[model samples]
Target: MKPAINPNKIVVFTGAGISVSSGLEAFRDSDLRSVGQHEQLASPHAWNRRRKEVIEYYNWRRECAGKAQPTPAHLAIARLEQKYEVVVITQNVDDLHERAGSRDVIHLHGELRKVRCCGQHALVSDIGISPQYLGDTCPDGHELRPHVVWFGEQIMHYSETGRHFKTAAKVLVIGTSLQVDPAAKLPKKGRYRAEKLIVNPHFDVADRPYSYRIIHKEADSIVPDIVAAWLEGQRWDYGLGRA
Candidate 1:
């Protein structure tokens, strides 16, 4: 079927829920315990006290991330790029969207497979397989840390994300409970004129009020169907003299 290429500019804001279908665990997943139980690791402060635990924690996540593959929802967005100018702004540190062939993804929460200097936000690079030990340093001898944006850190690409949203004609939000700040507030940052679409198993929008269509289902199950339906409608509309 001919893909729906919305002539309007398209953008997406995604969260960890999108990757849950591919076996990635969300921070609040019922099966997984809290960070405190997981050795109280994964923060800049924790890393400072016990760098080994922090490295080990992320190493575990890296292994899980390495094994996880992109779901159909990810591929649907990638396919959308074939017909429109697509820009993805994701809170997930996982690289699934990129792996699914989406070209322009802005990782707001940093990436799991990368490491950068703690002293300076140096260029993040791939350090495959193992944990980044204490001696792992950038060219400047500054110790490297997990490239993730922890609880208190400011998102690195905030300004760029704002700019992308400002120019977007349509914004689709998927798999997120809009409860967290900054990242949760991203979809609202876009121009008010942009058409908003929300896809989640349960829509959680208490803080902000925006008109949206809530598709109640798993992302992997619903997203491909949504994309295909939209595209097919567009094809039919164009084929008929109605568009």
Candidate 2:
């Protein structure tokens, strides 16, 4: 018997794992690969302590982000919106979800493609060129920095994300360990625990009672099937083909 999407408002919360297949790495795994490096480069302390290096570091990542492509998992997730009211809440800063055609996407972390002024966050702009220099500034003369949510900063969309999570009729968690705070807790703190589905190879917190549908696999390979089953009224033949 094929499983069906619980007929409810759907929110797919994605993480770094989903984007890994697209050639991006988690901060811990990147070239500046260290917990210390992440703290230094991706933290507000680091941003303030070494603004020039931080800008250089993010510029390098942005260049890589610009070249990265959306994976099959991303494409499958995008297709879900056709049959369900899907909103993608992704931890990734890349535009892969948008590129793959998902219209309603929220970046939990601030984006890698955008640069912002230190003084005015409203002064954000796309980074069309690599190596944003020290001189890059807003009209107000504040330095332009990567619009990412550093360690000391609140996530890019804090209240909006929680409100959506609280009201979501259903949530599909993909390729995340559920280790990050606040976001990790939202799965259980909703108006309705609208049938939680988790797809990931490994998660530290598998003991959570609310998560019932656990598909332990990489997303691109399995997500399409789930989405397909949901769209086709729960008719799926996993080994045979579409039923």
TM-scores, one per candidate = 0.85, 0.85
Residue pairs whose backbone atoms clash in candidate 2? none
> lDDT by residue for model 2 over 145-215, one digit each (tens)?
88788776777776777676666666778888878786677566544436567778786544553734666
C-alpha lDDT of residue 18 in model 2: 85
Q: What is the lDDT of residue 51 in candidate 2?
A: 76
For model 2, state the Cα shift of residue 54 in Å: 0.9
Q: Write the per-residue lDDT of candidate 1 for residues 4-41, one digit (tens) a residue.
A: 43446778889877887787764436545544534467
Model 2: lDDT of residue 98: 90
Check candidate 1 and list the clashing pairs: 4-231
